[model samples]
Target: MIPRAVSKNGYAVLNAEDPLVYKMKELVDGRVVCFSMDENNPTIKRRAERGRVSCVYENGYVTILKGKWKVRVEKASNIPLTYGGRAEFMIQNVLAATLACFVHGISIEDIRVGLTTFNAGTAQTPGRLNFIEVGSCTVLMDYAHNPAGFSGLVNFISKLPNKYRTVVINVPGDRRNDDIREMGEIAGNNFDRIVIRAGHYLRGRDASDIAALIQEGINRTGKEPQVRIIPESRDAIQHAIKYARKGELVVTLADIVPDDISHVQEIRDQILKKQQATEV
Candidate 1:
């Protein structure tokens, strides 16, 4: 749909770092604008070789390079949506949107303003890196269920400077057992502690089945992660919060967005109340 929409003299923005984006360019009949993390990525080089119209990237700064006109905007760290540039995937999104606007003849000043002001909160982008702070700990709540999403989150989590890390996670029963284990493996690699919980809405597998598969993945990592099997999602969250310490980062990989979000928020409120009492 994207390639066809821009097939008729319209501008198309592609992720120059993604190999699939290069194939997608074949479907696009108009000028292909590209965005990438690095300016020297093979896809970006390929796009340039193919005479693509424009490209946006971060080579120390958010830069847009076209044929003869070049515009360098504020660094991604200044953009709230990029989470101080820790969310590398979001930085790619910002690049794509910026390049698309540039193709549409939007002023560089306007694009810069939009990039700086754009906010990604629970309301703005729910179930995707909703950072919640309770006292001194930072809790990241996300609904990353697939391998790709988990991989992206693992990268972001690795960059967080925390004394300890905990992950409350579950995968849907409908997914292949291997896939569920892979998610666990990824979490195990990054987190110091882990809680395997039921998603509360399993897509039709017996209780403990999915959790067991995830455990298999966790154990395969060879890292002696402090592990727990809490079947209920809410209970798992409560367990995580109970043992959470200051400077620790708790990541909840929720399967059901709405239910998990409500439960997390409730836990956050409880933590706040406890903190208030301690302060008193």
Candidate 2:
């Protein structure tokens, strides 16, 4: 249905690295412009060799290859969303978005400005890896609920400086048991500590039941991290942030993004006030 929906002149932005998504290239009714994090991807390479258009992450830049012409939109390090080129998923996102804009006749300089100017953690997009610092603790708030979403967060976390990483996860009650479990397993495998927040929009599942299911999956990993369930999201956030020391990270997969961000912002404000008082 996807390919069939496109007119012959329409553009289909496809991912060459994803086998399933790349397969759509064969079926697309419109012109296909592929993007990939791998510059040397066989399909993308072949497209470049044949004088076709492709976007790739070559060296440090998000480069567009138009037959021998290399147009670099921006370096991943310069783009705040990619988190200093460490967030591999964001790199792919940048590639796709840059290619989409380019095909629509957006200039390279405009694309570069957009990439460098867009800050995901601002008030406009607070639930996207917004960091709040309180003394030694680095608290991150994001709205990662599903397995894939948590997996992306985990990928970003892996790129962060070595620290005692603890994730305060809140799985939506409405998701499938498998999805919740998968998120739990991902957190278990990656984080050093896990705090499960049981509140808001649990659908039909009981709070305890939801927490237990996640803990069950975490048990499968044989990791040392233990599961603790907090019935209140605020308390869960506090618990995760309170005990963190220097060189430690506290990640909160928020159930309510606004509430979570506001709560952390207040915490940060209090800490800043106390620090100022101490200096005086």
Candidate 3:
């Protein structure tokens, strides 16, 4: 569909790492610009050999290759959206966005400002990796519903310090049952504790049924994690925070963005107040 829309003069931005996407270049009548995590990716190498343009992750920076010249855009570790460059998917997204923007003549300095200033906060991208601190634990809220997103999330969680990880997941009922189960399986395999909750809309399925499917997936995973079912989103968030160990993390795959963040913030405020009262 993307290639179908590009004119002969327009450049098609592609991910060199994805064989399937790189193959689409054959279908494109226009010039192809590529981005990749690997600087030595075959396509990126071939493009470099010909002095074509591409964006790549090199030495911890998002670098652009123009013929033989290497232009550094920004460090992935400095961008808040990539969580200090640990979120590979976010970095790839940044690379793709940067390549597309450059293809249309967006300046490198403007891109740097955008990357450095932008963040995955509630005020910016709500429910997209928003973090809140309560008591001795940190809460993470992200809107990850599919397998790919969940995999990226799992990777992010794995990179954190060796602390107890609790995830309050509430996948949308609109997804295929398999996907929901898969989410459960991934969460179960990684997190130390799991809380399955109800999404904003259950669509046609019952909340209990959705929870049961997730439970089934957890059972399929031989690795056992303590699992709980709190059908309400608010209740689920509270449960995760309440049981969070000192210096641990409570992660929530939020269905409702701002509402969930606010809910956790309220909890944090209450915890702060109680601590203040005790100090007196």
Candidate 4:
């Protein structure tokens, strides 16, 4: 019986030896299934020594019972998952969502709605997959600053219809130069043109240094990919948008803050409102 509570600050409280503690002691009072352990039970040591059973005494802790061994259980507040767990959870959730939507006669649009409405925390706003329509061209803003995501995005974009050319605007965080460089190298081979931007350099690092690192990686690939260094992210985006042809695709990969997208959404709303008023 384990007792746990969440504080106002969003932290959890877990304590051992509480009244609600479940499975605290194995073979309590010489019974295989006893309600609680008696303090005077002498068999407790012998049972622990035999390693017959184990228990979880507290909300965030597990206790192991060995022959003639009794010790305090360590509390584990948060159980971190490995890559296997992540893959399992992702597959399970996607399958469940797909099945639910299919059984309910939901369309593709309805799938998006269900994900956004019901699975708020689980479904993140599509980072690189969010297609922004600018005239006849398409632009995408993605958080693909990592090598895996960058490679995946390149492969995905290459398969898209009317993908005449791909312009990659990569902006990596200052903290991860090597990661950004590797990402750039991967992107250089995949995209037609590569534009490197200094992303999040305001956090006490020189933008030029980060750009140089990315350039070094790109040069090492020997692909001679068209590379340009743009310090400002907004300028990089504007430049990419300007160069896009009717059927080309411009992809901006960066570590962007959430508020940046919100601001863009607000601007879009204002524009829509003005257009509506004009029509009326």
Candidate 5:
């Protein structure tokens, strides 16, 4: 007897040991026969009229009926692995392949290869746990804006060596006034100085109003930490950097901007140049 496996996308395979399964073990194949929003396709209608195999796609599965044999909807969830699991496996495989290539193909016998070198390099990847030393202060750039991200960044920075005060600049563009205010409250309890700037609001909301909304949230929190409103992003950054003393952290919240808007690279470069000039 051949075992049968079903998938959420309406695919069924009989006999796990079948030759077809062996040949296509690494591939996922499916076909969409018809797509209709309001009405069924003429072919499906004809099939139903002829009392042949009838199937309907819904909720990532297909419901099929063939004479007395009726098959319930089979979705991707019916499969042993989900789409998310497959994607995660592929990512892990890629990382493994890259590591194997470096370990087996490269010869690093010349320079002293120490475990600390790999540890330090791995710690510096963006969106991962990374830190930048600016004068006596350590700045961390992370892709965290939600409540979870904000909390994680604050917690991590708090544990760093000599971390006295935390300055969080949270400007989540897609957040509602209430959401932004909640984020402000979260920052208020954690950081010493909280700077709220208008981020990328693509929905045509007034930028100043968004800033004010965040300020309202801070006011509600009742934790005063030198809250400043600088509309220009570069100036806001400069303000944070100027006031940052040794043993303090400055966090800048950034969002994805549309193609039409100008990039902040120029502003960043100007700030860096100005900082260097000021130092000298």
Candidate 6:
């Protein structure tokens, strides 16, 4: 779609750090502009030297230094979708969208307004790091079913300040055993507690098969964190929350996002009711 979009005389906003994007840039005749978080990326550096790049973003600031205009926008965290900067991937997404708009002659103020107004909520972007507060615990629910997604979530979770962290995860039956194993290893290394659950879509394997494979992977790492298999995803979530306390986080890599989110909201409501009763 990207290459086809540029073929029709539309400007292409390339991720300069991506080698595939660099190759695509070479094949397109239409005006191609680049954006990058890293100034040192060879493509961005080369384009910036030739004044062909549209925008350069780093940390949370974006600069547009193309065409005879220079503009800078700082505090990308002002974009509500980034969750106060905890969702680093969302920041990059905002940068890319902002750069795309700028290249298409959109006003800076409009782009800024659009970004700051966007929020990641259940209604807007369900199953993508939907944050919920249960009593004193923070729960992050996401549809991260693969190793790459798991790694990114773990990296994000590691930065949050919490006394203990719990993760709800399950291995997809269709995934390679090594991939499933890697997911378990990542959870084991990053979280203090883990709940292995079975999602609605098993992809062919029996109920206990995926859990056992994931557990085997976790055991291979030699870390003895608190881990259990609850089989049902919803029950696993409830189990995690039952033991959660203040200054803790529960990150759920949900397989069934809608069901998981509904269950979490129900759990949150119950927590709120209990707290209200105690206070009253």
Highest TM-score against the true fold, candidate:
3
RMSD of 2: 2.6
lDDT of 2: 0.84
Deviating ranges (above 4 Å) for candidate 4: 1-128, 174-177, 257-280
For model 3, residues 1-280, the per-residue Cα lDDT tens digits are 8886789989888989889998999889889999999998988999998988999999999999987889999999999899999999899989998898887899999999999999888888888888787899999888888888989988987898847999998777798999989988998788899998888878888988889888888888998898988878788888889988998889888887878988899889999999999999
Instruction: Give model 4's clash tally.
Output: 10
lDDT of the candidates, in the order given: 0.80, 0.84, 0.89, 0.49, 0.48, 0.79
Off by over 4 Å in 2: 1-10, 24-30, 49-51, 274-280
Alpha-carbon runs more than 4 Å astray in model 1 = 1-12, 27-31, 49-51, 173-176, 204-207, 275-280
Candidate 6 local accuracy as lDDT? Answer: 0.79
Angstrom error of the Cα, residue 11, model 3: value is 5.4
lDDT top scorer:
3
Error (Å) of candidate 4 at residue 102 is 17
Tens digits of per-residue lDDT, candidate 6, 1-280, equal 5565565567777777778766786667687877777656676666666867467666556667654455776566667877677676666677678888876778888887887787788888899878898878999988888987788677777777887999988867888878888888888888889999887778898868878778888888899989988988789999999898787899888777888899999999998899899999
- Candidate 1, 188-255: lDDT as tens digits: 78888899887765878975888888888988899998999888878998788778888899899876
Better of 4 and 5 by TM-score: 4
Which has the higher lDDT value, candidate number 1 or candidate number 4? 1
Q: In model 5, how large is the Cα lDDT of residue 139?
A: 53
Clashing pairs in 3: 51-67
Off by over 4 Å in 3: 1-12, 22-32, 49-51
The sequence of per-residue lDDT tens digits that candidate 2 reaches over residues 1-280 is: 5865767988888889888887887887789999988888999888988888889999999999987789777889999988899878788889989998998899999999999999878475778878777677888888888987788888888888857988888787889988888888898899888998886888888888888888888988888795678888878888877777677899988777888888788877877899999999
Query: Model 5: what TM-score?
Result: 0.49
Question: Which is better, 2 or 6, measured by TM-score?
Answer: 2
lDDT of 5 by residue, 13-112 (tens): 2112224533342343431122221115454454446654434433443334334444433342332222222222222222222222232333322111
TM-score, per-candidate, Cα-based? 0.86, 0.87, 0.89, 0.50, 0.49, 0.85
- Model 4: how far is 220 from its true place, Å? 2.2
